[model samples]
Target: MVDLRLERVCEEASKLFISKGYARTQINYIANAAGISVGSIYTLFTSKKAIFDFVLKCIIDGNYMGNNMALPIKESDFASLDGEILNVCKELSENFEKHILDGDDSYDFKQMISDVFDIISRYGVAFLIFQSNGSDSGVLYAYYVQFRKLFCENVEKYVYNFMEKGEIRRCEFPEHHARLILETLSWWGMHVKYDAFETNTGISQDVSKNVAMDALLHAYTI
Candidate 1:
């Protein structure tokens, strides 16, 4: 079991690290934010790097491992498109499209945006921390790249399914489209939420989602 105080310290440190970056954030800042003494922080973590490592561990343990983003597509699944895997994919595609599309002409753009935002918001702080520390060499960076690649691949598969169903127009570069959508959602749902220097636009999540989805749908849909 995790100690309550230690958990509190990690939570506070995560926020500070997100907002201020690792180099800029200090133990004193985290200690104050956690409502604990500097000594208490030291007792729990030998150094700031230790606290960051713990926070990264917590994020991994929180199931942000990207395994749940999409079903694994086996080589055999592609060879036998009529296999059970394709059947499962079709079912998932139907369920996913149900919430986003109405016929082939209309879409619930706002709802799709909301769903994406909600999913990304769960990892907003952790993503911000990763972005801030992206230049560093470590296991965290490896996990970050791995998660991003997995998500992009998942989106690519979804886009390909939509194309096959004639629900969306075929793109010259489907993978690029997938990356764009994912990066856009990451920016709005995570980066903008915790930016330290940018002046807040005071834009609510709904409005941001509407605007973003509108532009993306315009580009991707017929």
Candidate 2:
């Protein structure tokens, strides 16, 4: 059906954009990848920019194919999409602070760990696309760098707070251990799905998160 091909166009275009970057991806290349004519692309998209905008909006909405709305997908404000990602980055840090209630004896580290993995799993596809397409000095890459630093800072805060309170097991080079825990969560939560070298890529997100959280808990607890 025309609608299915339309979806294919968007899906293939997204992959090309992820692999080749937006400016470098050609109309002919996208058409060929989608098994469609350049004219067919033009029938719906007024310009290559339109196609890119649609794909970007879909990615921001969730992942590959969006809600599959009717044809000639409207353009999205890049500022809005940019802000959405930036806000997510900010919220991750803020949420960590919210969980770190001073002297709150009932705070649950396992629940916090679960929530972070859920966020990563929910946005994994979009995150992966931006990471691959983002140039080293581009805004997208900068967003990723900001997120990494914030995540590390929060993890450090948690480790130090809990260690001082005699909660988590104290260890030599605690900062390094915090980094290790972050990497472990990152791998299983997000990167595992896309890791070409990972043999267990087929595991469900539930299984991945449980295993990752268990590893961190067992490794860090007394």
Candidate 3:
């Protein structure tokens, strides 16, 4: 079972880090947002940076519970973590969009849409943090740009190839449609839950995937 305080801390920290940027988000803010005391926050994290590091690890590791995790990650652990973060993001960015390009016999538009949704749903929060806090996190921001460019290029490739094959509908500009599709997936997968101005649709992640994919398939499928 996930520790209640740890889960709350990670959730609130991720939200605050994305919305408020790393420098502005303090332990107290995370604690307040998490409905825990400032002292309680320290018990869970040695410092704000530790919390940030822990959040990044959880996002990448998908192990929010800290099951088998060392509690209260130390500053010593932060050493070399930035490189680790970049490496993980780099590998995923390099490989994820390739999931769409499995030759003609295996290509499936619905499956392609699922792959897009899965990647964004799984990794988009980290991307949002990288985007929103570019000033404080130049390294992550630069990496975020590369990650986005790589994914966009792959999407464009898939669109152009399938269009040439007469599978999915062809657009005047496959690049634009690639971005459009990405925006749709981003909104449903990540932004809807985080955008402060967005009205609550109470849509679960599974429902979001289905709705977004079905809509995209309707618009793009031949």
| Model 3: CA > 4 A from native | 69-71, 97-104
Candidate 2 segments exceeding 4 Å error: 1-56, 59-70, 74-79, 101-103
Over 103-180, each residue of candidate 1 has an lDDT whose tens digit, in order, gives: 543433344445666657665666678777876524555555655565556566667766776767888988887788
- Per-residue CA lDDT of model 2 for 18-49, tens digit only, reads 66777788989999999989888777676676
TM-scores for candidates 1 onward, in order: 0.57, 0.74, 0.90
Error of 1 at 63 (Å): 12
All candidates: CA RMSD in angstroms?
Answer: 11.2, 3.9, 2.1
Among these predictions, the greatest TM-score belongs to 3
For all candidates in order, the CA lDDT equals 0.63, 0.71, 0.80
Best by lDDT: 3
Which candidate, 1 or 3, has the higher lDDT?
Answer: 3
Off by over 4 Å in 1: 1-12, 32-46, 57-116, 134-137, 196-211
lDDT comparing candidate 1 with the true structure: 0.63
Candidate 1 lands at a TM-score of 0.57
TM-score of predicted model 2? 0.74
Local error of candidate 2 at 120, Å? Answer: 1.7
Q: Predict model 2's lDDT versus the native.
A: 0.71
